[model samples]
Target: PVRPLWAAAATAPPAGAEWVWKATNDVLNDLYAVLRFEVQRGPLSRSPSAVSHANQVYPKLMPFLRWWKQQPDRPPLYYATLDVKGAFDSIPHQKLLEVIRPLLREEDGYLKCPYSRWCGKTGKARTVYGVVTKERFGDVEAVRERGRRLGHGRGSFAVFMDLVEYRLLSRTQLLALLTRHICSHV
Candidate 1:
């Protein structure tokens, strides 16, 4: 089970806020370790076979195939793509909290996220606390700085290029590309 960072810090209460910060670091490290393990285990397979068969084909055909097998007449093949502008940014904090609250284990004043693997042992899991005052795009500088600090390969320039490409293509253009190529064709 996950322990609240505040609780760990409070064990040596005289150490004050710094203890809390240390506990947070410990929790985050634990989470990162789990992520790293999963990535290394090949479970996050990004190969062409995995991506094409598992991600694209399965999601696209599963529901349609199920429905078609149950029906008497052959249904026409049709598809539609949806575009939600600023999908993550549009979510209200209270609503987001409502969705997340059920997954939390509450004790005293602090909350522990029991559902997240950050609760793992091995002294790797660490947690950080912060408030979201605005959308992620509104705090681009902080995001860039954190990414740079972490030495994550994808930098601000790469992110900007992706955003530019996304803006250049409409939903129709994306759908056209999807329909024009099969897994082998691509």
Candidate 2:
């Protein structure tokens, strides 16, 4: 199961809060760690402008800004911070899974469905989890556009998943699980 950790929002109203999930005794934590390691070390980290940690931002951005200031005809430089209150909800789950599918395939031998032998409410061994719904919110670009507008230009299409309840056994089911989760949170 997952535990929730809440913190007061930095700039939102006093009643607002932000949260993240912390896994405890999760069977998939090892897989998650391995996936995170592989993803961080892979192409994602190779981007010249990619800065994962807060400390890296100052070290990375300051020099570039300084160099730009010294240039003959430098365009105006601007920096802005975003309020990512509902960031996770704005991303499409299907597209997110697709982006990570290739990476997931790379770990094929190491990736096995943890709920392969688990039973659902049907009282039978279930190979898949979650239900499919025809309820469509909007397109990926539309969702991203809303996120960009809400976040003041910065956006991402990454969706968080609960590995225990909605195992990655089937893409369709996973999408439904993620969609449901996002809808509830939003």
Q: Which lDDT tens digits does candidate 2 get at residues 1-186?
A: 323434333455445433433332233343443344345657857855556567789888777777778999988776632212222444565655455445543422322222232223333332321121122122434433333332231232222223444222333333344455545544
Error of 1 at 27 (Å): 11
Candidate with the greatest lDDT versus the true structure? 2
Best candidate, TM-score-wise? Answer: 2
* Global lDDT scores for all candidate models: 0.32, 0.40
Q: What is the lDDT for 63 in model 1? A: 68
RMSD per model, one decimal: 22.1, 17.4
lDDT of 1 by residue, 14-66 (tens): 64234544433232332223223233334434533233223576765676578
